[model samples]
Target: MARKIPFFIQIILIPLLIAAILLVELKHPFPKFRLAALVLVFALIVDVAILARGKTRNLMVVLASLVFGLSLAEGAAGAITPRSVVKIDRGWSVRQPIMGWGPEKAGTYHAQMIDPSDNSIIYETNYTFDSDLLRHTVSADSGPAIVFFGDSFTFGDGVKNEETLPQDFADLTGGKQHVLNLALTGYSPQQFLHEMETSRFDKVIGPDPKLFVFLTAAWHAERTSCKAYWTAHAPLYALEDGRVVFKGDCNEGASLWWREWLGNSALYSYLIEPWRHKVKHNDVELYVSVLEAAVKMAKEKYGAPTIIPYLRMPKEYLQGTGFTNDSIMQRLSDSGAIVIDASLQKEEAAGAQISIRIDGHPTPYANRVRAAQIKAAIDEKLPGVLLADAK
Candidate 1:
């Protein structure tokens, strides 16, 4: 019989090989590393059976058991996470290669809103997307309007149609100001430019809007560089020669198998998306470029005054997120767009009045507060735009 390999070698060599394989898998772009890991695991098993003996064998067995237990614990945690429980099919989104995903269908869906703080306090509500794939409007269709463009905050994720920022703005003006909400959920500045280029506003709401309001949040910069999952399939653009150039749909060059696989994996999303954000190229330039394009479009197409209301986050959160209060304000000002200072929302958020307890979205009260600030800014800037058709 062959002499068994020493226990120390079995424990040290096997674990080192496994660790090396994992490190390579994590750092390398090749998919074959997974196969290598599997092969290494199998080889480790066979080697242990043949070579490990007594105390060494016992240690290897304990290590393997611990790894198995941790994996089970991880899977269980992922299974019961808040994200898993709130998987209602709202049917509000359609897959668009240009925008990655967009509001294509119109319907009201009874949805469950999960509070990120505590998932147990769930709220069931009706969410509606109009025929134009924008948030349902409350104000009447007549009179000059202010066009609102943004993502979920502007789309009113956890609030009713009447409680959205745009709707609240309309209400503050006492129905004299028509607010055309062109905002869509998960939208970025890139999509805003696309909407302008396609003349979606003209086709959906008639002549260009009197004023353009671009609501921006800190996450918009990170989202602009996201190319995995839904964003991987959406249309991508880049700034070329100081102009925005369409780079076509991401799915055209991406692997369908990889795309579909990663899109459905919660593990991949939970682990990889954040990692990508930290390691990927800085997206601030892309975001600023898109904003510049949008400002130019608003000026040239409709000669409308573009207002950028940057919904501020906590100061600590803004520090390393590629967006500073000063940098964003300066950029928009340089683009000839008026910038709304972050002071109002900053105070509201600090006082815990700007967001809901569970859902983390702007509450009705928060929207009302924000709308009031926006109206004040408009009144200060344009003087009589909000009071144009007052009774």
Candidate 2:
């Protein structure tokens, strides 16, 4: 005798699951994901109308097997998986009229990094932003403005308010150059290009910049390619007739369901994430084009040399990942970028520890090392600016 399907499990529970999936699709609709979601919903509907009426016992067996299997898998994975609870200061970002998300607000926030192993707080500091949404530079803005651009490494993610690269550079040079830090956390080179393309360039920066510095990372390849999930709302670019052109934001037709669903899952993070990261969207050619375009524009518009700190090849990236792209450094150099050696030597790395324990982000001492190298690059690449500042 076949057992009847339970009203609660099939009629209520399965429908609820379908509803949740539909909601996610509505929120972040990707074409492929929507088709798959619709197919899954159809299967659930079939089970309710057809399978539930006839093969009740078999359906029950399958449901029970999936539930039991997933429970054991999730539990086993959770035991070994690194997890941490985060309490962030809200209202840090303001939504742009376009798809982009803007800067951190001008306020102080209690920021801390936690050890996932023992749930201990590694360090706590206040992150303070200025009226322009930049981290407060250690020195006042007065001299010829030297602008720094990149992600959090340039923004000093886990360091003190005054321990950033721009601040360290200002202090290293006796505050001769007025530092303008325009880097935001989770930003890519795309944002830098976007800034150069828009009117926000003149509005955000007062007067002409003395120089432009970009801290490129290996992970930035994924960021500019729109492979990183955090870049879903970031500006997107494409090459047209060997010129970089703005397309749209990353959320347009982006397939981010895995990141939305299983990103935090240890099993998924360890297994599937690597598989997906193997192939990039448009690859580094597009990346270099965007960079080259920004460089050309900066030279054409502001007559300032764009300095790209050579970071891809010499050592493992700040996040402990190696860049497999061979021509990344050479390409930038060929594109007329001032690529400098920012990688720390063994003795310097020993004294300065390349990364913090919380994540593989650069330490304060490491920033100072890079800043010193950058200042040297500035002296060599933009000697005119150096002479002007010295005058």
Candidate 3:
């Protein structure tokens, strides 16, 4: 009976073992760690069912015990994890098949980030969007437009209407520039590319857009790759024969089942999620390729110079990638983009501050500083527009 038990156990485990083996190989571009990971998984699966030695099944028993123990740990971690309370009124933003999450509807909605431990409100602010679903522009009907593209930093995550970067830029330029801020929270370069490809600009953007600017950050590299958990629905692009081409949504990868499942494990959250979302380096070439396409389209479609900001990759994201941040900037320059300099990007840590102590987003003052730099860049490129052109 005891001998038969091992056989039956092996039979039951075989299918899962096979599935896990297959999953380990799915869409994993990082070849350096593949071998070690395969070895570890194989040993675990083998110990659980392959081994049927003499008296004591100590090693096998230990491995089986860990499987259950880790599961329990995962459940516990998930239970205790602090979840912020977020409340948004109706028609805030709609779901877009291409952009994953589309523009915010024109209305005022309030948001806050509360500390779950003490149930304290960290910060509270209201957001107002235009009929075109953009955040804020001095006057969308006025002057030559300067379009902005970026994530929360450019979107002014926690700031109010008058304090956003685009708003600040308009105020600084005497409201002469019709700043079209297309920035949104959780946006990646793929959204930018998709919007341009679909000609969303022709219908929505104000007439005669003078220049486009993309605010730089280290995380843009990861987000653009569509490997992040929030990006499953994002329009995915791949490099086909050295050209970046759209290949539908990222969810089309049936092989990426493992990332979806394993990513939910709170044990994985502690052991891997932080580095998983951002800690490890992802495919830079694919990301930069998408960005390259955006840059070209900006010029070809709008006939305007797109100024991209350049920031060094934080040292933590330096591992597991062949190219450096400088290489990313080089890719932009090679694509006919002239300037991605210090005037637009601030590497100084002190320059960025937490907004109202709510989160890591830039404060209103920080946005003002960044806006001044962008205005300076625009003045140099466009020249005559800054003659105190207040609307």
Candidate 4:
């Protein structure tokens, strides 16, 4: 007769076995690492069970263990896109386009090549804006300054430098202003605040003429807490002695956080993005939170009244889309900043022209329209400032 095990031993071992399998299945702590740990625990549990039963199925246990381990190994690697298949250059943001899942030539821009088969961004740019950060510095003689801040839309992805909104805004103001596009791609409100704190625009553009125009999008109001952008990358600038310092290397804190949070989870790179992008707009509070913070910051720091220009999708794109512009308008009204509702233009001939492309970024035509809208809004909101500068 086989020896009976204590009830306590059975309870302990069985639960551990179950936990190991469940952890492996749930892909905890980067999946593959959990699987390896699970396999070892499971093998030990099976061995103890076999010995307790005095069974001759030891050969079967060994075979099962081998099969399980092999399956785990294959799953780990196969679940992710091969790094070799992707060729992202180490400095550009993912917003800059890649050609066929690879880096484009120096001048040409392409969007992230998401694999249609799996919806994974097989390749992404490193989002290093060292050069752009450098360009933010201006001479005292560089004339009046306006700092432009936002996300990919503000960064001018599909358009050239001259055709971008900031450039057009600069031109519209007739060389009276030097607009700095401090808007990094993929920057949410929290990151934008961090950029503001670190970049020390106060030091760069001192006193009153330093206006800040925050061209925020409707989507980013819900994205303020996306710390993931800073986790894997080095900071473009570090705040030192109330001035910006170019660190020229990744921060240790950021690197460690990414390694700990992300680890080798293939699902993180393979699945999370498409899942995240498709998430519907439901959190109105989060959007409000970001808007309030932006308004507070603008009121306190810059003292220059904030101007928010309404962004509109091409009319054709809005058809059949289950979206309501009312909430956005409401949010803008509540923010207490000047809102330029350029979307409600009755005559296409009345406002400046914009891009006809449904999905592509704002065209040069759109930039001019946006600039004109800003001009009108500024005149209405801050009576003396804009018009006085215009004269």
Candidate 5:
């Protein structure tokens, strides 16, 4: 007679074996204890079947063990699949490639090159708008200053520190203004409003800033509704009493963190996004609402001059792309902010041109032109403030 299997072994083995299968899908690693457990369970099942004289039971046991074992091993391998980790700084974590604008104009291949402008190389502030910074930028600040807000274009994606629009403004004005570029990459207007309310730039400088300059590109209004934009880019939140609460996961690489680093391959987007809007919600309306709210908040709560500089593209260039609508322009005008349409105005006959050859962002030369535009607007809209500061 074959040896009898222990009752305890059967109970433990059955559940563990089942669990192992489930864990395989999760791709969790297996420790040595699990391997030994599997071996013992298989041996016990075979022995028990033989002792009971269960015909073909041994075959069944052997097949089950082999299948389960292979699955577990595969899961273990997946679990061990290397993950790239980025160290996050105080009050925020910027997951590169996670929530960023899809790859460059050319395209990415098997070798996914991180955008040179991304923070993976340089630890810039808005590269990844983590929870801490997001919370603080909108919160109350103490002093008078200039708060500059918007998406990547305002965040200085391709440009360096001193070359950003805000920096250019500060430099041109002789640094009299405390200019904070609160813009974040892949930022929706809602996110910008959140940053405005939560992060208190005023505290660092003074009370409500003298001016609130918001720079916007045409595409930001549409891309705001993207699910990948929401998931990978948005701040963290947890369910609290059936309500969502911002937990602000400041830790770099927590096990609970669930974010995809390698999103849709760039090649896929090049082929797809241009053809399809690929958004779940009405981003245009949402963008309009956010802008309206921002204007209201800045005027009523902060008492600052608000400016929305519109980066206009030629109709020919925007033909294939879906950004040709005048809705955003209408919204900017309706919001009561100064609208500086760069493309509409002929390049200043006197000054150097700042247009980018390959991309939409303004070049260093272009930033100077933008600075001139802002100065011109300030002179017209807030002449008293400009004159007082000049003195």
Candidate 6:
């Protein structure tokens, strides 16, 4: 007792179902399971269309079966996948006028970090930020404080509070020195200069810092110009007439609807980020200029000896690429900043197993190793800056 459905309706349904499956495949985070489900769904839909034999009742049953199957598949996927929880304590960060975003809240952020390579759960940890949005102390209240500024490496991305470079340095010095960490995750040379210009380093830290250190990696150069996930919401800068110039904010005049929908997708980011970096390849000059500006500010305002420590790329990745950190280091050295080449240290670290397997950030051992190298370099190069028995 069922009416026959038209052939045209079945034809339309087939293409629509395939298109729907394709869209899901593109957006789904779990590709393996999603692809399997897609294939199954496609096969089922085709079989249902053929078996329906133009019966309306069969078509309705097919629709119901498809809906039920998809719901079950989604539920299964959800049950197996671990959820990522990120809690940002009050006063952690606020939107800035030109910088787009900065740390404003002074509390701890707890989250389960996931490895992007395999989508595996890495670890759950807490990240604490001070009133100035700094992970370390605002200033050395007692004794001469050493200040460090840079991106996530300096921010101690994968490590705990005590495992950071500054903390290790403080511990190595027997806790006699104050180590100020002004580093922000995803910071470029531009943000470092901007923070120096705006932050209350003198009032908060009190007295002049004995040393100022700037840490960077080759990837940071691309961050200066690319609108990737890390730098997309940050302030833009350009080098004009041999001076650092603020261009504007990246999130300015953008619609939140599209950003919230597409920008949050990891797949979207994975695809678009590389394209953005490729298009904005001429950022080397901007990076160099920003470094010069930071060193100039440190020397002029704080009279602190500036040390720029850069992480070396892996030898395998460095091959066939014209990219080198030497030119940047040389430029910073020319501007009176002592450069610490971490290439040799990186090789040594490989032998020591000092980095995480899933997440490639430096481990606690690696941080300690870097700290030791930095202390040695300071003792050898700057002489009286560090204590004689600090190591």
lDDT tens per residue, model 3, 1-391? 3645456666667676566555665545442223433444555555554556643566666666665566466556656765436555556656666577765457787877776767787667887887887885665466667788888878877778888888888788776557778988888788888888987656666556777888775567667676576676778888888888888877755645666656545566566666656533346767777888989988888887788866565655756676767777887889876555542244345555534564767778778877777777666765754545452
Q: How many residue pairs clash in each candidate?
A: 4, 0, 1, 3, 26, 4
Per residue, candidate 2 scores C-alpha lDDT tens digits across 199-248 of: 46566566677788998856676777777756767888887888788988
By lDDT, highest first, what's the ranking?
2, 1, 3, 6, 5, 4
Model 6: per-residue lDDT, tens digit, 84-200?
433344444566554555677677876456765576767566788776667854323476668887777777777788888778877877776677887766777777777667654
Please provide TM-scores, in order, for all candidate models, with all chains considered together.
Answer: 0.74, 0.79, 0.74, 0.55, 0.55, 0.70
Report, for every candidate in turn, its global Cα lDDT versus the true structure. 0.69, 0.69, 0.69, 0.52, 0.53, 0.67
The top-ranked prediction according to TM-score is: 2
Candidate 3 regions exceeding 4 Å error are: 1-71, 85-87, 253-265, 278-282, 338-358, 385-391
> 1-391, model 5: which lDDT tens digit per residue?
9886676776666566566545642453543333444454555465455444455776767765884674466446435533333332332323433233222322111211133334243222223232324212222223357677776567665555567777777776666555666675566555555555665444543564678888775555454443332344453333346333444431226422432321222322334435555332244455555676677777777787678887664465445444454756777678777777754255545554554433445676677677678878888877655425542
Cα RMSDs, all models: 8.4, 5.6, 8.2, 11.2, 11.0, 8.1
lDDT of predicted model 6: 0.67
What ranges in model 1 sit over 4 Å off?
1-82, 87-90, 115-119, 227-229, 255-257, 279-281, 314-323, 342-346, 349-352
Better of 5 and 6 by TM-score: 6
Question: Candidate 1, 218: how far from true, in Å?
Answer: 2.6
Candidates ranked by TM-score: 2, 1, 3, 6, 4, 5
